[model samples]
Target: MRDSKLIYYRSGCHSANFTTWLIMDVIVQDVNPAISDLPCYWNRETSKSVGLQSTRKLSCLWNGVDVYLPFNFIKNYFEIFGAFSLNHGVKEFDVSHSNSRVLTPSSRYNPREEFMHFASFDVEGRSRVLCVSAGEGVPLSTQWNPQGYFYPTQIAQFALAHYSVHSQAQHRENIKRYTIQLEQEDTAARVRDEDTNSLVIQFKNTLEFALSSPHLVLSLDLKINSDIKTWFKVQLLAEEEGELFTLLYTQSGIYIQSDGSEFQFGFGNKASGRWLRLTRDLFTDLKKGLTHSNDKKKAKKLKRTKLKVISLKFYGSGNVANISLSDGEDLRMFLDGANWFLENQDENGGWPSNVIFNQGQKKYPKAAEIQPGWYGAMCQGQAISVLSRAYHVTRDQKYLTAAEAALGPFQKPVAEGGVKTVFLDRYDWYEEYPTNPSTFILNGFMYSLIGLYDLQNISPDNVIVQLLFKRGMRSLLALLPFYDAGSATFYDLRHFTMQTAPKIARWDYHTTHINQLLLLATIQNSTVLSETAERWRGYMVGKRAPHN
Candidate 1:
């Protein structure tokens, strides 16, 4: 194991075992499960309870190096980890500013809302690559931001409950960061020699993704299966009065395995160590899932399904031509889930609390609200964001109308200045606690609007759409204390470019889409918006995307 270049991490332990998924571990210390004589997790100091804590520190030695981890992490570490961190993350790029780095094999980034960036990329060619990281939140997200009063100290990745990474994770813009070396590779190099040379790149977990696109038809995902065919693509259209999501497939084979396999995926923030365990578990089990199914026909069927699952395309990276995978069936499910979400949507034109089914009926949970000040409105705005995406993806006018209806009820000024947000109660559910709302719900509300606007190209007449496109400019002009040009990067900057100061925090992977929207919106009307359009067009025309 000492000389082994391939390293695997599960629950933070370097495991040579291929069976483990590279998912984050969950730790719990018991306050004592009095009823079952089980351990209890409590802080003991504040009379507060904590999860399980094991003293066992495990490690998988590699290349004379030891990667260690603590035990009792299944529940204490992995299970309770947050989906992603809310910070810009720790990535070190060369001084050039154009070159970006990846944190782990399974990681993506969220610089601001509206744009999607990679913590790092595992490239197979100049273009063929994969990013196993997530950005902090949707576009215009400032909830977890430090300067934002509501979640001021909540920037770390580990602090948030159920957040896979640590809370309070932030980027020190003043300092140049560097990615740690454990299992690292230059994706661009892979992209450079994709056809002549083949590589099997491994991420933090068992997840294995191979990208080889010589031409479209001959592309390879995991490994080059000399004997198989796989391709699934999509075409969106607006029918009679609704939108449709069309799934097309070119080739496939189905398969089933003997042993049960693990599967999971996540996106949000880059610094989040989420990819480690999940990828580990997924790739290992993926191969295992094929054990019993060597049945060529079965393999073909599964392959087809996998292709279709990956076909839903979005403008990935910084350009429109660089199409990348959207969140597959889950992305669609987000829409389907809205059907159930609609009933629970607040009477206002927005969503209610995010529902978790229990007795079969959809629920609007008032308990999760941190403060009584924001509740109904919080749920409502969230619903519109989802509904809008559903409509955009499916081209469903019905869904768009549903989204409009949901947001209609709660549209009120966020804090004044004609900057409106859905009103949400900040009161705690049981009345035992009171949490801050003004800043918290406000960010959520704005984020939802920004997210909806990210899909504006799909529906030009969206009421929320125009508001998002034009509001920030007016908001800045109104001069809200929150508009920090020095530290912020909003999507609709083009609309404000001529009015904005020269220095901007270049967050490449941020709400770039909103940037895209502005660039595309103005690119067509370059004549009228010449001064503003020229600067905005950098998103497309300018090759160098300044690093934030």
Candidate 2:
């Protein structure tokens, strides 16, 4: 038999095309025992009018008859009044389409109005139900208006809903499967090494974890043949979209020089054998390198460039082997250094300029020889900050006690080996040393101020600490006139009493000064100071194009 297309017949008119047909098996049942007494039958005349010429044989079910209908003829029986009491209405009906069954008269149906409920099941057992209003205040006896303009709209909505749900489920499943595959591949890659001479370290998981790490510590057991001056050539391969690019890191700095125009910035380096720590600042340098371009607009556009660390290659002169890499979160590698600091702490609750613990002697012999007075104020401030943070993380009273004791030097009068000072013309400042009377360096003072702020987190009620913090901030703010706003430069010196000013300005000093100003403004919540920091930041942006 030739297939027949389901077409709606309105009044006595039938659609001309009958080439493609959709077959459906439907069984109507009434759940209410009271409603089961009502009679229901397929409208033979209506079905024939729509080209459904064959009479479907009915079978007895629990409370209703089972009948097969051409997909087009299902709508004609929607208003079969005798199937159930009109007062109660045919609350719901089930239609078997394809492999699954759909129940209609969903929650969207209203007793006062008419609606079309559509449902379908796929071979995979997935089901979809859609409900649409026929019209507001439509009579139930009028049989859903198949010829109405909204009829096609409702059908399209149901179709779109089914397709969207199915497609979304398929898409989600595909993504989950792909993720699992990648994870397996990553695990395999971690254990497998590429055939190469030099040592190469690559992350198996997504590059995001490695790139976002604040610090990366590379530890290796290196063997060199002769006394050769050698440096490791570090390369980072990143993929953006489908294109691949490389960033190179040398002792000089990190750069990407494709067209011979390389912009490099130096991040501090440590010794070779021991763990080499690359701080968050290195990532900042990478970001700067990626965004560095001749055209400012183009540079800004590349701000969101995401670089995945596909591979890390270290090329060196001698044999580089047994390489391992760790980020900041690797507590196993971090705890060793923290333990050393705790063990070597001075009896006065302070650390010296330098402490060396000889492994053979099994004692920190250099601890006694070193003097805390020789250490710079900036170093002391950094140590205090470190200890305070250590306490914050570990909740150890020893670290807190040590941090508080370190603040004693900054609080003492200049006469006593401390930072307190009342210089010429009341130009007060935090002196680095009491003995060596010299110009106050902004960086050193700012470092101390930042340390105090960190300490303040624990001792919020310490009045003396608060006073010193405010004083340091105000003193720094007072020297703002020494800066050249036009050039975004800071003069190296601003002596007490405003005696002699140097014409020389350092670009690096200006950067540090601006950073300090911004930090102070943020912590203090001073609008004037904030505005000053903003002005300097804007000026610096135009002058040097530093990374945000």
Candidate 3:
């Protein structure tokens, strides 16, 4: 009992036995009905109304080491308690910036918004990954990030989101400051602060504000007084009919009418007599609204043109305030996450995911399941890609140095607390979730490879990165066939997990896999990759390939 790792069900001091010599102690906290008599784990200041003066805390002795479970520690289904450095036995590298080279921009691999959609939560200077929960209004939570832990996959994706926004050219040289310019001082158009001061621009008949230039993002506070039969329209580029984009608020709901097409927002009286703050990417919304355009010439022109919000024509009375414009705030947010990676990296040159990933239990056996305090290839790759781009833009040597140190885990095997492993004793597979039997997740592996490629592009003369990229590419090409499941593709090679049923990719993941392959094909010219991507794309429309 003293030698084995202790497991707690999280409701009480009920312990489950597990045999392992590793440093991690896995606490499997399954969801069950709450017991009224048991101690609650909430903070004393907040949960005291329920006759609870203090939060629950547990202490135990495991393997001759004293273990303390902190207050309100059960944020997720699974939790780990241990030293992160104990898992990785590998020695740390001597980081140097003298050998660092200037990063070269490559059009071959760019961060895609579709795949990298994780939200960033900034607590202090650190960036934590936001995961979806069942809570209403606050559907997303920082999970366990308050305890100095983070999810690598989410951090990587968040970084990629920034990389995508930062790579683009800025719309203008200086930030465009917007102000309310009233055409008249009459009740029909008035700019005055109300009691709340949030709704400052009030109008009944009509109002217009002309922009000196076009902008990408628009932020404002809006209040709807009553639902009117006539539309209260806010138009952009009203002079040009072909490029006209309008936001129509009517009895039904708020709708974005753009380029002869329209789409409605959420259904409700959400903005009725209540101030609703909105921040929108006008350019992206305009593009989505034009998805069904039949005219190629008009669509091309709309895509090329910089959209401008010039006039607001209100048929019904309403209030608007705090109008502002920007190129994009993504650069700031991305840099926040990037700096987090640089600061939070462990001595082993890897970012350890403090959250336990228990999703593999459906397909993988107990032995092949992921452990807590795990490091991922996808996370490392994504972080490297982000840092490389950071160096490219700012020419900061710290980013380059951190990126080089991040390659430490790739050199070691999964058994030695790294993300590298061999599949079928031939191809080198960078495991997204490094398990006993490697789960070679297609999208994750590709993301890791993209990172290596980015690092290699920056440091072309570095033989280590060159070999890693080349070897990973070779493995990717050879293992592409195993992932193809005739009609569709599998998410990972989990068929090796006690011969479980093949885990077919979902619609979204399947699309991401196809896109990743297409991106890889741009880097390495392989007919197999191109053909597979096109064939898998056909699967989306219910096209099937002939079987022998």
Highest lDDT scorer: 3
The positional error of residue 477 in candidate 3, measured at the CA in angstroms, is 0.9
Clashes of each: 131, 1, 0
lDDT of each: 0.29, 0.40, 0.59
Instruction: Note the residue pairs that clash in candidate 3.
Output: none
Sort the candidates on TM-score, descending order. 3, 2, 1
TM per candidate comes to 0.29, 0.36, 0.50
Q: Is candidate 1 or 3 superior in TM-score? A: 3
Error of 3 at 400 (Å): 0.6
Query: Candidate 1 residues 331-371, lDDT tens each?
Result: 22233234545444444443322222111211112222332
Residue pair clashes in candidate 2: 4-21
User: Candidate 3's error at 442, in angstroms?
Assistant: 1.1
Q: What local lDDT does model 3 show for residue 82?
A: 24
Which model is ahead, 1 or 2, in terms of TM-score? 2
User: When superposed on Cα atoms, how far off is each prediction in RMSD?
Assistant: 23.1, 32.1, 23.3
